[model samples]
Target: MKSSHILLLLSLASTGAAAFELGAPKNNNTDNLVWTGHLSPDTDSVTSALIAAHIYGGTAVVPEGINPESQFVLDYCQIAAPKPLNDFSQKAVGLVDFNQKTQLHPTIDESSIVAIVDHHAIGGAPVNMTQVTPIDIRAWGSAATILADRAESLDIDLPAHLACTTLAGILSDTVVFQSSTTTEYDRYYAKELAKEAGIVDLKAFGQKMLEAKSDLSHISAAEILTMDYKNFSYGGKKVGIGVAETLTAQQLLDRRNEFVAAMISYKETQKLDHLFFAVIDTKNKRANLLWIDDIDAAIAAKAFTGQPKQGWLVLDGVTSRKRQIGPAIQGAIEGKK
Candidate 1:
């Protein structure tokens, strides 16, 4: 065979032999590499998987929460790991470690990021393909479902403990698959993962997770603000914002005051060009946009005008930021003189 033909045949064979295995680590040559953090799903699952991978020879680091102020509780609240939570806590945990000064793309290059399965909208394009093993980011439901799907796809034997952790992440993100983001795939994976985790009743598991997240009695306004905070640049300016809403209209109504105060405080602290919060009534398909500092800027030349009554601007059929708020805000920013 010609040299070019030989190369082409080898390439074809490799492509044909490429199998789809979810949770298995790629490139098993572990000579100089120390760790691989499987970022996606909940911090707890990523932490658990990392610890396991570390046991065999590798360290693991997961992305911190939107605003990870508190110390990470690896095995707290019934989470499981290779070692006791106390032991994991005692050892120095690795962090993804991206700050304002550090360029986000190059940071992942320092270590072998084995797997990246995320549910959030991809923040920015990343560089470094040398060790880019597997990346799965689904906009539907939860990152947890993606992780579960990976385990199934790879035919990896998921332990009961990991299954429960995956189930909690799914329930938390999907709000028991009641959120508009939930899809058939999410439900399918949830059922499959629950079974693997030895959860007899997936619905009950979901309910319990929801209950645990809903226990907001102890959470302060600042904690709630940080929990869902995000920053994005638009119209030649950076905007820092936070979103807080209840799944039910009644819950939103009950916490209206707290949510309002939190938005105002967050706006002042962040010093953003424009600060806003959307109190989404998911069941009603409505959103109450709370304008903290820039009501005028938001509605300057736009069709919507006038101060929102009680800091609540009713938006019919506009609950999602990706579908509605993000586009609207971009348009407003672009249209500005």
Candidate 2:
């Protein structure tokens, strides 16, 4: 069968919109293309796929958000394009089955997946992974940027809805591209994607998204910790770091006491060798590091000089993980050796 005919059949299948069966590749691979990449399968990646599927006519099965205790069905299976699937409502899907543990399985049945894109450390590769085609995973700012790049490279015209979704994904994942993980590739691709989608004033849009997430009135300190929590092993010990960014140091400082207390509590509970909570003042390009272990203060003192100062260490030149924090931590760790 011709490739065009296959695509036409896929579009027609989208109209029926059945539940995604596991282990099936939705698109026929007469060409036997092996699209592969690392799949962490976070929100940005899932949402990016959803938008792309909408544009290309496919199903998107997205699980709930990070919260696992809440009783909600964040999972939604829907068709991506041609005026949205009628069976699925337009409301933003909430965390589905919050009680269910979320796991990233390497293979979804052939009937479910058309492509995969992600940005996290690669997990063990799977056998007979039929769903993900043209997988593109880079440990960078956002998978949305990767998807946008793919769409552009293929010369695939992006619909306005998909474009807006992609834009939002980039803003959220990159923290408006101010995150340490943000890369030049992310910025360049986002700019081009925004232009292609006819989105102007991306800066303002990013600000709006940041403001929306920054509202702390309803969020607790613990909630903030889990949003960007990561752990690493060093010197036969485990260290965990949580990062939060705010418009002003004072704004982050307002939560300083609570955040510090939370770090201590998390450290004891998780039994980590060390815990570091960093509040980044994006506007000033400064960072305030809150330490939960003895080495942290010493590490900061040697790395930055001066007294520990209220369990807080000020870093003037420190701004991002890739640019500043990662290097500082590496230096401190290496210095210990």
Candidate 3:
């Protein structure tokens, strides 16, 4: 490890961020480094990996298939999608968007993680990676925003494709700045990136991306449930939260029975104690929360303070799962004790 990396590790460790070492040594060869994001990656995760690899010297890879919005951004910007990476045996890895053990692939060598630029809480992260490497985890709305800001500060040139995708990432994660997670930095960078990408009408471009994200016409119920899902540990219980953003919420709500059945099967297969799915209407900025059974309905009622209507909880002005739903659910679970 470099002396600077050692100093950074020591500083992070003093803040109680260090955990047990996963026994992987630090690799200094930047050429061999690879950047990736969480499973079921959304637009921000996908774009952040590309941007990170561009600014840093490495290849960008995806843990799984890119979501629709991400694909739309890549195609629109004329950027090719990164290849998928299944094995992390000898690779020096950097993570974007998420920092959790549960979100990682089972085959990941925890010790090989040299960097993490994420906008989420550090849950079960192998913090000991800090002892041998540098990591960037902050409260920004999107990991893409973090990387974009870094590139800007360091005077790193962001090409047109990267700038466009970075802007798309910010829009997707912040829901066009409607999400509560949106910060001033996110807003500022979005505008700057828009100009750099030659997007004269930012809102129009964001609408296009959202429409692309809403096009789930040919996907199955099980695929929808896993599309933008995440695993969280709340109140000593394993919980799974899935969000499906669409322009036409009614179209998806019509398939409530199918989604419910799929949710139940997914819950059982993952052995999760609780599972919740929120179908978000981006236009109206609301969500139709679906429950699989009585237990899930009870939990939703407590978390959202809303009664179920025809087996769905109507959450008005609830778009951001990270900002609104997940925190509410976690609070409700903790409050029960």
Q: What TM-score does candidate 1 get on C-alpha atoms? A: 0.64
Ordering by lDDT = 3, 2, 1
Error of 3 at 152 (Å): 0.9
Q: Candidate 3 — worst ten consecutive residues by lDDT sum? A: 1-10
- Estimate the TM-score for candidate 2: 0.62
Higher-scoring candidate on lDDT, 1 or 2: 2
**How high is the lDDT of residue 99 in model 2?**
9
| Tens-digit lDDT track of model 1 for 95-138 | 22111112222234423333344454433223233333444555
The per-candidate count of clashes, in order, stands at 3, 19, 0
Give the clash count for model 3: 0
Better of 1 and 2 by TM-score: 1
lDDT of 3 by residue, 1-337 (tens): 0011111222343334333221222223564678898889899989999998887768999989988788889999999999998887778788888877768876678776767778886542333443345666667679888888778755789999899999999999998888878888888889999999999999999999989989897889899999999888777788899999999888888888999899889999999988999899888988889878778766777788665667788888888877789888887777841
Candidates' TM-scores? Answer: 0.64, 0.62, 0.89
